[model samples]
Target: MPAKAGAVTMQQVAECAGVSMMTVSRVLNDDARVRESTRIKVMRAVAALGYRPNISARSLAGARSYLLGLLYANPSAAYISELLIGALKSCRAAGYHLVVESCDMEEAAIGEQMLALAKESRLDGLILPPPLCESAPLMAALEAARIPYVRIAPFTRLDAAPYVCIDDAAAARDITARLIALGHRRIGFIKGHPNQGASRLRLQGFQDAMQAAGLRSARRDICQGYFSYKSGLRCAEKLLNRADRPTAIFASNDDMAAAVYAVAHRHGLDIPQDLSVVGFDDTLIATTLWPPLTTVRQPIAAIAGAAVELLTTNRRAAAVLRQPAAPRRLLDYAIVERQSTAPPTTPD
Candidate 1:
């Protein structure tokens, strides 16, 4: 009888590829010294056998878990869902598993717990999204633990730190300018929680755009929000209830934008007719609503994918790095204009 359909091993892979186990290992570990032809042959063998590396055995042999711990915070369902999809897809492609841990921003003990988690997992690297990335204690602990980590959105001024993110400030500024081009002089703004770096960057972008338009004093016109639909609704209510409402409202994210829609509905306002709204981070909620959001696309998948790529590839840092310190690559973002935004209308 033929060999069992499912039974496969590295030995078989080596034999099939006509390469030694050491060669196979080198290819799997992404050793650059290996010839491209040899790497392709080994990869073909790997595909043929449908062999999944024994992570545990590899970890024991290499003293590295080959696992990435992703620490994140955000209650937005759309944001979390998109982030997870991108992260898991990247991890799967790179032959690594992602361990996700949702953190509460208010918890003071989170830094200690995360450090303990990293130490115990023996993870090859870790991924942190803001505002945890901004936390001094968390940074100190990770530095002490000597675990390589990539910051998804850092609060500190970035100077070649390993990270993956869209240009939040630039995106926000672009969107705000778009609203101004649409003849919206009175634009209402809602900011995300101050703890998140993206939130701060986005707010700064709005301010920059307003200042460029000679609307610097418009800071008083913006309301603060926590990136939640409920927070969006409350702020939207406040803005609309005011004696002089903005012609257009800009929410830092899609969740808040949805809230603006709800509040507008409550006041019998016609979307794009009576009011126009724009949001950032073009997540699922952007389209699910009646008039899809005209917002800046965050490239969630690409960002998370890049983060995983950096983490997995860093596994070979010792061999790959010629210098003690290296710079990280950053990704770009785009503006996705949907139906929710339109030119301002004549006064009623």
Candidate 2:
């Protein structure tokens, strides 16, 4: 349906339904007292008349803004876009809107910013992801303000708080375990920026997998790189050009992993046969790369959807409600074994 210019009003739906404005309001609010027959009439009229309620007006009337504020610190364009799609879809479905704000990872006043957002008369709740969750001062400020929120990633100390995120370490472990099972003993790891909690968790997972396999991940086998294709290529060069090169490489995210492919190709190494590469975050780049990347899928949509729901859901302002039951949610992730991984070839 096309969105009409200017604001859509509820009074029109009331007039079209041949009912008092109160009746339309009651129906829209899902007031249980309204007769089912009346609701059906109002809904039918609503559909026919292209009725869209002005959320701003509703906020003024009910003292609820129905606005979800999304706070992000990640720099990856792909990650940001995916989260936006998920959050917006859920917000629209639930008759709410969103406000997005980006923050630099190193900012010291994240807590102050979050406090200001919560104090805003129009903001209902917040959806915090990554570094924000790990930020003690920021978390403390939000909790002090008693602003209802859902973290997109889990926190070690905030077990009681609602969150929607994937098992980052477990997913990374699974991906690494796959390479190990493929007989690639020497695996190189390309890390994302250290500021991201996902990067830390993923690196830990890789180490755990190697440890479980009775192997040690040496510092020489791992090179640091930010979550970028260029960084991946640079790190790959460092790892692959060595006299004793690892048989496989694992990147923290797909962008970096794709860079590894480019570097390997330039070095005259064939994917899977001479070297196998893997990555985390099975983004669109995973498929776009020459050989589809073997990576862990982060269920961006599901996590964003849950965050929006948690942020927009109503709760009493006075009551510290039992953290809204995490929307029976799980971050969907899978190891997409694509063209990027295989058994290592015997040294010629």
Candidate 3:
């Protein structure tokens, strides 16, 4: 009979599968040399027995710590939550543990914090999400310490390390062109945090769309934001308070777009009627709003999962080659059209 859950051992699993404990260990460690049939049989026995390996025991017996770390400094709760879910899922599948560390300190202090975390945790590898991914200090520190890492949506240093991202510029351009197709000649734009590289690419896309349509995007209509609800509130107020207010506004993120909804309601304006609002990063806030937000769907969870895969794959490759690898992955993005956009009431 199978052992009780949480009490199952590798020896029991091997006995159940008619395999040696060494074979079970190799399967659990994801050794590629294990035959397909044997791996499947071992996994079946593991599942049937509800076997949970003791990470500490496994580490003591092997060279690997079986620990991965995720370092982030982004302010979007939705983004971070999705990232965690994805990374955790991937880690579990790979028989690894995930340690999440938040770095909200200044740039000068970020490197030190990350290095300390690495040493303390004895992490096998790390995954970085923006704006930490774009931090030069953090990159230098990681390289100096020879810590394997993968980046999600890094703006600068594309060739510096492995990364996963969508074409931010193209996604921004497509969404902006969408507003134009709705006959919105005067559209407003809210830029994301200046610290991130994606912010610049997105802004460029918005500008490219407007210029292509032969529409003059006024300086006053383009406001700077930090990809936060508070920054969105400030930018929305600036644009909505103007006499020549834009008929539509596109924020760099959903949080800022949600802020626009609040400001529009305060000004006694109806969404998509008096003002049209759109955002990027089709996060939870996008659908929860009164009129669902029209935004660019950047697959946050998928990106995180891919980041973890890259790090694990790199670790395997380095074990044999004794050198790190840098690979880049570009995912796809989509423009989700909801009830939040409409043509301007009056022609430009």
Candidate 4:
């Protein structure tokens, strides 16, 4: 007899489908080796019986913790929130739990802290988001401990582990080129955090576009930012306060671009009329501003989800192959043009 809807177990589903419990498990885990006909039968039985696998029982049986860790040090709330949503959704789909840790420790202490956290949490794998993704000490500790990890937008050591990211340089270059095509010669650029690999790539793209246009970016036109609104404000002040202010400004992220908006308002400059502005990372802040920001959309949530998938997939492959190859994925990005950019009133 089939168990009650909420009480149906994997064993009951297997019996109902006339398949072994192992077949049911493989089907549930989305193992590619499962025959399509067998998979369909198992799924139909699962639906008919309302079977739900017991995660704890499955973990104990497989000698797996069924837990993943996400370590991050990024300061942007919008970015972090999107990342959490994606990771959590993927975890739920995979029947795994996520342990998120915020690393505020100094560089010297980060490795030790991560090592201790991994031991205490017994994480099956880890997901690293920028800045943290580029940490050598943390990577070294994880490698030494034989813990698997997936990185999102890592700056260096591309072959060290699996990773997922968009082409930051190409996206940055496209947006910068858009500003140039708008008849703006004197364009200001605000760089993202120096610690992030994307920052350097984005800056390089901006410079590349400027040079391609036969325009030279003055030293004063490029300001350093830490991917924070506060930093954006400071950079904006410096750029806008100058006697020869740029007709347009391109900030590396939406947060910084929003800061540019605030500073522009304070200086009594009308957007796209007095000064045009653009930003990257089409986070919520991009639309919340008065004149919606023209920015690059990097699919933050999708990237996070892909990172989780990569970690889970690699773990499964390693169990059988002992040494699965690390894969690097580059997702696509789009330039979302909104109300924030326009042709300069007077060509520079």
lDDT of each: 0.81, 0.79, 0.88, 0.87
lDDT of 4 by residue, 27-127 (tens): 87667788889989998998787676677877777756888999989989999999999999988766789999899736687888898999888888888
Task: Provide the global lDDT of candidate 2 against the true structure.
Answer: 0.79
* Superior candidate under lDDT, 2 versus 3: 3
* Winning model by TM-score: 4
Regarding lDDT, does 3 or 4 come out ahead?
A: 3
Which portions of model 4 miss their true places by more than 4 Å? 1-8, 15-18, 26-51, 319-324
Worst 10 residues of 1 by lDDT: 317-326
Leading candidate by lDDT? 3
What would the TM-score be for candidate 4 when compared with the true structure? 0.91
User: Candidate 1: where are CA atoms >4 Å away?
Assistant: 1-8, 15-18, 30-51, 158-160, 319-324
lDDT, candidate 4, equals: 0.87
Give per-model TM-scores.
0.89, 0.82, 0.89, 0.91
Candidate 3 runs further than 4 Å off: 1-20, 30-51, 105-107, 319-325
Q: Flag the better candidate by TM-score, 2 or 4.
A: 4
How many residue pairs clash in each candidate at the backbone level?
0, 0, 0, 0
Model 1: residue 152 alpha-carbon error in angstroms:
0.6
